[model samples]
Target: MTSTPSLPDPAGAGQPIVLPANGTTVAAEDLQARFVHAADANADMTIDASQVENVGQAMLQLLVAARAHAQAEGLHFAINAPSEAFLARVAACRLGEPLGLEMEKEREQ
Candidate 1:
């Protein structure tokens, strides 16, 4: 069975971009594009990664860059309900801080 990927809604502030289940390098470009579009449209953004089953360094880098860009623009960027796989990859890559993820809570979740 095939599942449709959840696409981000580029509308108002605090809009959430739900990450795909496979968060590897293959999805980095698309994810980056969506993240940019959402962040630009909204002053505050939430990225829901609860379905992520895999993660790659490239994806992590994109997220870090997006967070940095948002901060520079004085916008709020938050990762909501990150999956265990996503959290593990972030911890392995030491990108928790750059991505503004609360590691302790992430582990607990």
Candidate 2:
């Protein structure tokens, strides 16, 4: 017997989706749907990366795209309370500025 992973309901604007520990290609589709829903709502979109321990290019790309969509729509988008692993991964990919990781670090100071 096989079971399909359940799709998550779209989180309301300003509400964050706490990312799972694995932010890999397998998770990109679900994440994309959530971002699309948030964009369609025409409100702020926030993602909590506090639980992200392992991340991949697909996830990072998805986040960048989501942020761009929010910006183009004149809505706020933020990634809150990111874990060290998440931070390092963004930096390693040279996406700190685009992903707002650099700004987030400054805010913590």
Candidate 3:
């Protein structure tokens, strides 16, 4: 008897992130490290949420913090490739507009 794994509902609970093959993964550890690097280098960073899943509340906080850090340094911050599921989370949490996530990037632009 084999049990199948369940796909977590985006609204059900928080899930850990799966880093993408390219681009920086915005998981907890990376979020912290990136924040420091940006602070030291005074550069803005983008988070690609399209290939990301299993997002938890902590991850969201990290993004918020990153934006704040960038703003403090007068840097430009942006989010690209946010999946619908992830976008829903931001809307549900009322953070989409504040985060400046216009919407997910369209393919074949």
| Candidate with maximal TM-score | 2
C-alpha lDDT of all candidate models, in order: 0.78, 0.80, 0.61
Cα lDDT tens digits for candidate 2, 22-92: 98797987777887877766757788999999989999999999888888888878899999898888877
Reference-based lDDT, residue 47, model 2: 87
User: What is the Å distance of residue 81 in model 3 from its true position?
Assistant: 1.3
> Model 3: what TM-score?
0.64
User: Which has the higher TM-score value, candidate number 2 or candidate number 3?
Assistant: 2
Residues 4-109 of candidate 1 have per-residue lDDT tens digits of: 9955565233557778888778789877777777766755667888999998778888888888888988887889999888888887777788999878754543
Badly placed stretches (over 4 Å) of model 2 are 1-9, 103-109
- Which of the predicted structures, 2 or 3, would earn the higher lDDT when compared with the native? 2
Candidate 3 or 1, higher TM-score: 1
User: Clash totals for all models, in order?
Assistant: 0, 0, 1
User: What TM-score would you give candidate 2 relative to the actual structure?
Assistant: 0.81
